[model samples]
Target chain A: MKNRNIPKKLQDNLITIGIVVVCYILVMILSATGLLSNLLQGLLVPLCAYIILAVSLNLTVGILGELSLGHAGFMCVGAFTSAFFSKCMENTITFAPVRFFLALLIGGLCAALIGFLIGMPVLRLKGDYLAIVTLAFGEIIKNIMNVLFIGRDSHGFHFSMKDSLSLGLEEGGDVIINGAQGITGTPKDSNFTIGVILIVLTLLIVLNLINSRDGRAIMSIRDNLIASESIGIHITKYKLMAFTISAALAGIAGVLYSHNLNSLMATPKNFGYNMSIMILVFVVLGGIGNIRGSVIAAVILTLLPELLRGLNDYRMLIYSIVLIVMMLYNWAPNMIALRKKAANRFGRKKEVA
Target chain B: MALLEVKNLSISFGGLRAVDDFNVSIEKGQLYGLIGPNGAGKTTVFNLLTGVYQPDEGFIHLDGEDITRLKTIEINQAGIARTFQNIRLFKELSVLDNVKVGLHNKYHYSTVEGLLRLPRYFQMEKKMDERAMELLKVFDLDGEADYLASNLPYGKQRKLEIARALATDPKLLLLDEPAAGMNPNETKELMETIRFVRDHFDMTILLIEHDMKLVAGICEELTVLNFGKILTQGKTSDVLHDPEVITAYLGE
Candidate 1:
């Protein structure tokens, strides 16, 4: 009976897609064993991260039309929470088989809780005020992680550069998080399988939410707040919903991030407001309301700096030029102006002939 | 029982007293008009009642409970829906989606339910779609449901605005200038739609209309404001003829 019904559920999206995904996995496995490309290996993890961050952040900035410069705070929260849980439970006999899933859930819930708390008071403040407040909150989080001393080890607080390096925070002493070095020894459990599965699941959940009635209401509020209220929509409710969901997705990204890194940072000074803004940049460059644009923007932005390495001493200069060119193209009023000019020139030649 | 009652209501925008001790009582299933020259505080009164601004001096009652200081959304939830003087549809969304947004209040599903598209969610969504369709059909807009609100011609946009307002199932509908840019024939149809909705929903309407012909045709009762005060009010026939209302509001 189960076999008979397998084909029914296996229609187009659910089962057939799984087969394709498995086939792709097999190919990736074979390639990794043979002559794999460093470009491919280096691009994989970051591409996964960008896919999550860009799409999740789009829910806030595009769907809700609220500018936020602190998304990485939520991601950090999820990462730390999940990393801590898994580390503490690593050797526990009871916490086996589903340890990783449980950590991810805890991390997501923690991030979501923080999101709900922050969204309540801050979303009322509009535009720059909201941006500044969220940015400040992110900074505060980074500082707290830096200064909060957990315990003293045999040498001192066990928070030394060498220990940190051993945990993979840095290659040398300049890891930037000295006393409050990044958490380490977080089990590196994320692979292409888990990462790809997560990205697909997030896509399904987010796509469904955006197409549903609540998504429409949030978009309505984003378009016109006064009109939405007049139509009896509880504006804050939907805003909070978007905030919480976006935070949870960021949390999931964090979980994947910490697991892949093995060593975690209890306090991530680098993953602060600047990181959030970078994510926002991807969303805007991609086009706010288009999810496809967001994902593509994430991938391009993640790989662009790496690809620009061949620029040598002038890599940043060349990179900035490329960015400027892309932005100019983005804002150009007539995308087909060059085509039109060429056509006009060719027409004059034909007329003369 | 009165549908709406405002007792000694007043609003002060710091130094400016926008609405000063305004009072009005409207009955259920009645068509009422609030008329004034530009800046007579007519729209201010609507804003105050709708909780855009809380009146400093009086109490407002909808049905029986005093709703003088409720939030805009709460007031709307209490069965008061309104349209803007400037058209404010969700411009990017389609007409049906805009109306469906208004139908959000009737829906009772969690965000998870919405995201997961549970069977129950689909059932509720189907019901909402049917209701939104019915509302559009009533306004002869079922055909244009998929068209973006901003793309609609001026008259059809006005109709869509009202259709969206009705989707909320309001007991009292406030329409602030429902006929600003409509042509004569479109205006005639809008006038019929207004009356039809009034009768169909047994609605209590408070409209801030500039069209005298529209006010005279449909309104059984009217209140005219001049200099932030009600100049004259009675049956539309009586108020239109009032010297103060005509000179101060209805123009020369």
Candidate 2:
């Protein structure tokens, strides 16, 4: 068979990439035909952002086997840093694409740096303790962003934790970040096409990492810490690597998110523990460690509420039901056995044909 | 010089001395056995030697270098590898990947190379696959390379663990209770595998086993531990026949 030529891991990765590509093509056709709704069109960029968030979180939760509740905190860090960079360089960088691209890099790197710093001490705690600490960190980041104010004038950029007036500016100083209001007038540079490209890049990075030697080391640490150490896999190094990379990817998603909206604020609804839990919901429902599943789940879940707008009150009821069903489908022992048997039967039938 | 040497290795848990003033010397390519009663500190010695537990008062020399204070990964890099008393395979990973993880330090490619799928990544991965498969074939686990480690039958899991340990290319291989849960038929087969490993890999093995038949059948030297101290140490046959050892095991 032609399929036998490619390695199984490669084939799986290609299928994931193919799924994103196919979806993009379908969306493009829909929009070209003018059949796409306004609401759905607006949801596209955020949908891509959520997919990236879900996949990146899977690296920490599913692959590294660490429970982190501060994912949105990293996302918050990325959004603010990248948004701040883009705002400051908006007139200087002139070109929109170049500015957004640099913002993405800044966002990802900033998140990664923060992730490494936090991971140094936080990763030392496992299970519930790690989750709680991350949760606190997320809240702390969001709270800090709330009180923070920054302005620019003749004396370079001024930073203040108090108020905008405290940032003693020279002549005509532009208030870049007003406390609680966040950065405004950010160029709406994010689009559906760029989001899809980022999703593909994220998938490529995650899937390739999972199959590589470093990926093996990370997964081995997850599987058996003692055995991994005994076999010469550095435990702390792999854990931090996975955590930092995961945070960086989340930051990229944050960059996409920040640029999509005119005003990007670190609100509880957007950058709090609730937001982290929502992304985690996508990862868990999609099947932990299953990259393709995360993509599909993010798309379906993001679109579900909008698609079910007519139901109004019953929309969330149906969403919760779907969550339960998906959990059972992915994790329930009996369901798993049934799935295997069904797959085997189908395989045998195909062979017979 | 011996391939592995230890002097006054000891560790205590709270008020309890888990292992006390332990010492051993194993020449290259020799099969050494450690035996003792149920609570005897056999596995603790393996832990100390492998750097799972740093000795409270002693030193370990592997291949003529002091690895006494090295961490577990450093100890493995310094040429000591071990299997757990209970099989500790990467249960979620493929059998091949389990072995590949052991080949981690032996092969090299930057993380960026791995993520970007660079030329070096492909070259090293191909080498890793071949080496991992060769190790699996040694344990006759080549056919099940894609099988999850947890899916393997118990005896094969044991063999896979040994294969994984050997993949690190360690100078000293420590197998803790290799025949703990094996049937006699499987144990007989394992004894042959162990012997083959010693001859083929030129490995120096230190194993803890309750199965006297497997030990007596293959071990060249033996140590008997009782109540955190060595009761006897000598040839396998002589240690097994020692009266004090018999009393420690059977009770007078």
> In terms of DockQ, which candidate is strongest?
2
In terms of lDDT, the poorest run of 10 residues in model 2 chain A is A1-10
lDDT of 2 by residue, A266-294 (tens): 89989998789888888988888889989
Q: Model 2, B83-169: lDDT tens per residue?
A: 888899999898889999999999999999988889999899899999988998999999888888898999999999999999999
TM-scores for candidates 1 onward, in order: 0.86, 0.96
- What is residue B21's positional error in candidate 2, in angstroms? 2.0
Scored by CA lDDT, what does every candidate get? 0.78, 0.91
Instruction: Highest TM-score: give the candidate number.
Output: 2
Candidate 2: residue A174 Cα off by (Å): 1.5
lDDT of 1 by residue, B91-176 (tens): 87878788889898887787788777788787888898899899999988888877777877888888888888888888899999
Instruction: Supply the TM-score for candidate 2.
Output: 0.96
Error of 1 at A214 (Å): 2.0
Distance from true position, residue B50, model 2, in Å? 0.9
TM-score of chain B of 2: 0.98
